[model samples]
Target chain A: MNPNRQKVLDATLQLLAQSGLSGAGLNDVIALSGASRGSLYHFFPDGKQQWVAEALQIYAEAFAEGCENAISKAPTVSQGIANVFLFAAKMMKARDFRSGCPVGAVVLDLDCDSEPMRVLCLSIMAQWQHRLAAHLTPLPEAKALALAKMIIACFEGAFMLARLERSTAPLTLAAEQMATLLEAQLATVSRSH
Target chain B: MNPNRQKVLDATLQLLAQSGLSGAGLNDVIALSGASRGSLYHFFPDGKQQWVAEALQIYAEAFAEGCENAISKAPTVSQGIANVFLFAAKMMKARDFRSGCPVGAVVLDLDCDSEPMRVLCLSIMAQWQHRLAAHLTPLPEAKALALAKMIIACFEGAFMLARLERSTAPLTLAAEQMATLLEAQLATVSRSH
Candidate 1:
């Protein structure tokens, strides 16, 4: 991506994070990116929807990359799970709760009938789930898959609650609870040996 | 609420369930309720936002009542927890995943700075959490509170994923995972005895 195009996408993401899809207007995108109207039209001739689709794709990849990075840095799958939570909590707090998982917020807004957006969201979530499953394969496939979905749910739910409450308590508590869940899973497997 | 006002509120909710806050417009509400512009404005001078707020309140109460009803029908707290999942799964399937916990959907859309909407959302969630905690009090207060949040998160997250993935697999899997968590908690308590 060119520097100007990257700037426009980045601005779109920040606006979406702060103001949601409907709330983020085209003018806001222009002002945030300092790009001209012609530039925007040149890049995204289809207007807001196209711009949003591109932005969602970018955000999804970045989010997935971050989770992969967290997993790689941790010594065990359980520790990696904890690291994901901590990383998420830090991201939420730093953005003052304005930012949530982009895929999460967009999926809610996208029409399920819209094949393009639907496919985009599914592919993103599937990738993350695959990464999570990879980490958990060392434990148990079924348990790991189940936990991955639950953890994703917890993370999304906590982000919603944290934003609504304008406090980090929900995310912090979610992380702690998830840690408990992960530990319990490990303990169960260990004891069976 | 008057008969006409109640109709409007109910109609708003139906539209919200299908298309969400932004997608459901005043014309849609009027068409659904078969109400005139005069009647809508009479009940909600501030228009869409006012109607959405009231609709959210009504939905919250209805959801809480539904959960309470499910719990009451069960033979034990654990059974009640299972019942909540079963009932939720049924409801989600009935709507084909178009509907979710209304308060959760609204809570996700609300701006943190919108004090009135924020308070309404917080109160609704707190009430649901309180009810869950109340049902689990016979177990352990701390564990109950934690589980209550987890349970709520599971449902919310599962609903979101189910809708995004266009399948009930997430909800079914979430129910199984939640059941496992509950059983784990119960076992830990029993072992300490």
Candidate 2:
């Protein structure tokens, strides 16, 4: 809530995106954020792990909100899915593929990390899925969950490819495929209704 | 080729899979591998970057071989696709979700890392896509590439989700979608022939 706390969180999240979790150390946070050690520790007394958790929470919340906006603004669910993919592609391209999903970069590095860290990562991921599925409420509950998860997987997958190959082709292709699937599902639902 | 060289390589990779690139340092490698510092530098004079490149090469080779084996053993391309996903699920489950794609963790953590690291990651990713598409030569080249990249993205993305959520649902769903897509494509090719 404090200005210093917000600055520290944003800096840490940016570091996570750029260099990942391990390198997003407390010193990096202090250096990048220009936040004094006193202010940083005052906000995050538990140090690096605590700082990471807070940063992850902030990023995840913003991501969830963005998904909701994308879903709501698109004319159709298929369009919504495509928009999400396209938006990610544009962002990655602009960043020269140097930036990636903060959550994803951190999550990959979490395999042998602490329990608190794992829980934070898992809960954020689960929250993201729930948010995406919420936009698909028109579909059956079971179907919505499956579809949302698949779409999320494709989104995650697209980013990985785009980052590696330094091209947006993979993301574009994923968008097309997801759009097709969404159209087919929506058609079936419409016919049934 | 040396036993100690192999041990050190394996330990670094395991560290990469678990703690990611930044944390998979010389110290972590030495500790996890129980290989002497002298042996590590002896095998890798250029230090961490060289060691990581060797580990990446090993993982890429194993991954390519796995792809070849899966393609050879399956009766159909669609089934081969499913097998890959199923195998990933099994491996993740066995490891209690502690193990992930070694290449993936490194790739994500690569935004601010060295140029050599990015090249190795990109080359390996590109190689995997080419290998998968090779198994789908029946499809038009463009289509095959698109499909293969999509499948790879799904696989990479699935592991990300599986590790984060500590469940195989994302991977399982991705496998189902990919299998269905592959089956439809193969049917079209058969009809055209």
Q: What is the interface RMSD of candidate 1, in Å?
A: 1.9
Cα deviation of B178, candidate 2, in Å: 1.1
User: Which 10 successive residues of model 1 chain B have the least lDDT summed?
Assistant: B104-113
Against the true structure, what is model 1's DockQ? 0.54
lDDT of 2 by residue, A1-193 (tens): 7888889988998888876777688788999899999998898899988888888888888878877788789998789879889988898889887777888878887746377888888788777777888888778988888888888888887887787788999899999888877776777788998
Residues A1-193, model 1: lDDT tens digits: 7777888888988877765666456898999999989999899898887888899888877887888888888887667777777777787788877766666666666544566877877887877887777777657887787778878877788777777767776777777767777887778888888
Error of 1 at B63 (Å): 1.0
Best by lDDT: 2
User: What TM-score goes with each of the models?
Assistant: 0.92, 0.94
- Per-residue lDDT over B1-193 for candidate 1, one digit per residue giving the tens place of the 0 to 100 score: 6898999998888776655666558898889898999999998999888998899888888888988888888786667777777777777788777766666666655544567877888888878888988887547887787678767876777778877776777777777666676777777887888
Question: What TM-score would candidate 2 get against the native?
Answer: 0.94
* lDDT tens digits, residue span B1-193, model 2: 8988999999988888766787679888999888988999998999999998999899899988987898789998888888889888988899888778888888888755477888888888888888999999889988998988998898998988887777888888888878877777767888998
Chain A TM-score relative to the true structure, per candidate:
0.89, 0.92
DockQ of 2: 0.71
Deviation from truth (RMSD, Å), model 1:
2.2
lDDT (Cα atoms) of all candidates against the true structure: 0.76, 0.84
